[model samples]
Target: MPEYITLTIDGARIRVIEGTSVLDAALDHGICIPHLCHMRGVPDIGVCRLCLVEVVENGRSKITTSCTLGAKEGMVIRAHTEKILKLRRNVAELLVAEAPNSRAIQDIAVRCGVTEVRYPFHHANCVLCGRCVRVCSEVWQSKVLGFVGRGKDRHVALPFNERPEYCKRCWSCIDVCPMTITPCDGPMKEGEEYLCGKCASQLTMIENSPDSCVWCRLGEGFQCSRWRP
Candidate 1:
């Protein structure tokens, strides 16, 4: 039998299994928390800051990633506060600016209400979400791909930039990468990268009910946890 703990999320009280992350608990109960770098069966590293939430302790609130914050008895979590929304929007904007070519990132930016990116676009291929590296190592157990380098030079790569002979060749890495799907306007040129807000039409229902799940396809491009059976 699984042990359960009760917690309050955005004024709603719910009981979830012990050891479940707050992000999972909310998503399972139909509360939407924008997140990347999180897979249902994989351990969450909170690489993407989009799932930021407020943890009310005493009289003050501390922001943290819900995917890494476990649910506990009597815990209070605020996922859609004005502060969190603004912070999430900023993070989403940065992600889109970093990799405007990804349809998944573009959709997420729209969901986060990113009208424009203030930062200069790097047009990098990866956002360091670790979805590919984590899924390759954790889920597939192949350990074929990993992060190498440090700081701005960090990136995912096969060992020595060569595919290993023992690799499972599952292609899970490619399937999980956000960059696999080009933007609705198609891939942009180096100096012509732009944020794709084509899916902004889907935001009406989401804006009306920020916390409720509308089954938005914003996450479909990257296989959001909500779409997992």
Candidate 2:
């Protein structure tokens, strides 16, 4: 069993495992912290900066990413404060201006109470979070996608803007992307290629007479097992 650590989040006492992040601990304790680019079962990119919280330890206070900061004993965490809220709202506004077409970004802006973006719109939508790249390289182990440019022009894609052969087309990048950008297009099949991570078309063969479709054998409801010929 993993060792547990107790911490207070917004005046609520909660106990969590040693390795659990402050965001995870708060969620486990039913504490809602505004965040984006922090998905379950995915690496914490901490680029959104919306989950920033003020952590006071020994009277020293600092803002840090709750998604990446692990809960430690004797740590004082202030999840919601006027200063933090203002910072989050500003971040949301900037992100919205960058990705004006993104529904996710618009929703976040509304939630943060940001009605307009004050910065000049350049349309560089990519937030440089690296979630797409990390999901492709780290989780899928397919190094097909990467950052092609540097700084403001930084964006993830295939080398030389050309798709590589090693790409499995698993669409893991799409699954982890926080913005509207999709880095890779998967394999084509029957006039319907897998456009995103949630869908795929792969061949499957069954040796015995199964009363269901081969794809449905996994119990995912993709197809009925009774459709098997």
Candidate 3:
């Protein structure tokens, strides 16, 4: 039998199916929460910690990751209180510093109310959202990608960071990433790959092959017909 739960988010009464996450519930009810890592068909790891909400349970209120927290009957939730907005701003600030070059992150930071970044820019490549890792393991069943190390040095990598012969060459991770969606509006380099879903061009051009996008880390990763110069 199907189950349901009624909850209040920002004082709006809402009913959701059992197992529906608080983030998903708020989204279904037209509540927009700024988040970087929530993707359809991907297991919610809550690693981004951007979809946080204040939940009042049993006369106590605590901050929680909305994506991983299931909505329960009689629960009181607020997706964006002053406290939650402040917390999101803090997280976004760090992220902007970590990936200062990404337009997506820059725009998101503004949306999250982060006007300044206190940390120095690192120009990093990965935000370590674990979408690539999770897709490799859970979706593709190809456990080729994984996290190495821990803490400030932890990163997602293939075994030994080498392309294994068993790799199917699928780039499903690219599709789910919000960063690559509006990537590199600045310039293009020959013999280099570019992912630009916003400008409507997704390509990985070799110097020799100008017509084929046959190879991608995420095959059929992004949707676009506009090839830019």
Candidate 4:
């Protein structure tokens, strides 16, 4: 028999299999926790920091990424508190500022209640979500892709900056990349980046019910687990 653990999320008691991450458990029960850099069946690195949740203990709370947080018996978690929403909104804003062209990032920003971006746009090409590198190494076991360099120079690249002949050419890396899906209006020009709030209306459902899954179209091609059939 499989062992199970019960945890409290947003005042609701949830029972889940032992060792399941809090993010997965909440998502399984239709609780929304926005995230990127997490792929089903792959080990979570918690790089995106989007699935953050507060764990209550000793009359206080500690914030951590739910994707890396294991479910334990009697655990108390708060996924949508005002503090969390504010921080998550800021994180989503930074993501959009970093890559305003990604429809996925734009949708996530709207879902996080970002009406404006406070930071200057870097307009960088990648957000370093590591989806491609993880998918290649963990899913395909190819290990052909990796992040090299350091600081701002860091980025994903083929080993030795060259594609080896043994490469499968599966292109699974590209399929899972968030950058592949540009904004509906196409690429933004230099110094012309702006938050795509066209889907802002969808946030109405989230506002009314913070914890319920509205099945917002935001996750369509972003492969958000909540959007899965």
Q: Of the candidates shown, which would achieve the greatest TM-score relative to the real structure?
A: 1
lDDT per residue (tens digit) for residues 1-229 in model 2? 8898888887778888886888877765555565667765567879889788999877888999999998898678897778887898898888765655444555445545565667655445566767778778777888888878677667777887887888888977765555553223422233231212221232122213111123322212111112223
On residues 1-229, what C-alpha lDDT tens digit does candidate 3 reach at each position?
A: 7798899988888899877888777766656565667654568889888888999887889998988888888889877788898999888888777765455665556556565667766756788888778877788888888889999899888888797887778987665554564344552333232222332222222213321222322212232111111
Error of 1 at 120 (Å): 0.7
The candidates, ranked best first by lDDT, are: 1, 4, 3, 2
How displaced is residue 156 in candidate 4, in Å?
A: 0.4
Consecutive 10-residue window with the lowest summed lDDT within model 1: 219-228
Candidate that would win on lDDT: 1
Residue runs of model 3 more than 4 Å from their true location after superposition: 178-229
What is the model-wide C-alpha lDDT for candidate 3?
Answer: 0.67
| Cα lDDT for residue 225, candidate 4 | 81
3 or 4, greater by lDDT: 4
TM-score of 1: 0.97
TM-score of each: 0.97, 0.73, 0.76, 0.96
Give candidate 1 regions above 4 Å deviation: none
lDDT for model 1, please: 0.89
Per-residue lDDT of candidate 4, residues 1-229 (tens digit): 8899999999889999988999989988989898887777789999888989999998999999999999999999999999999989989999999999888998888888899999988778888989999888888889999999899899999878899886789999998888889998889987999988887577778888778778887856888887666
lDDT of candidates 1 onward, in order: 0.89, 0.63, 0.67, 0.88
lDDT digits (tens) for residues 75-133 of candidate 1: 99999999999999999999988988898999899888889989998879999999988
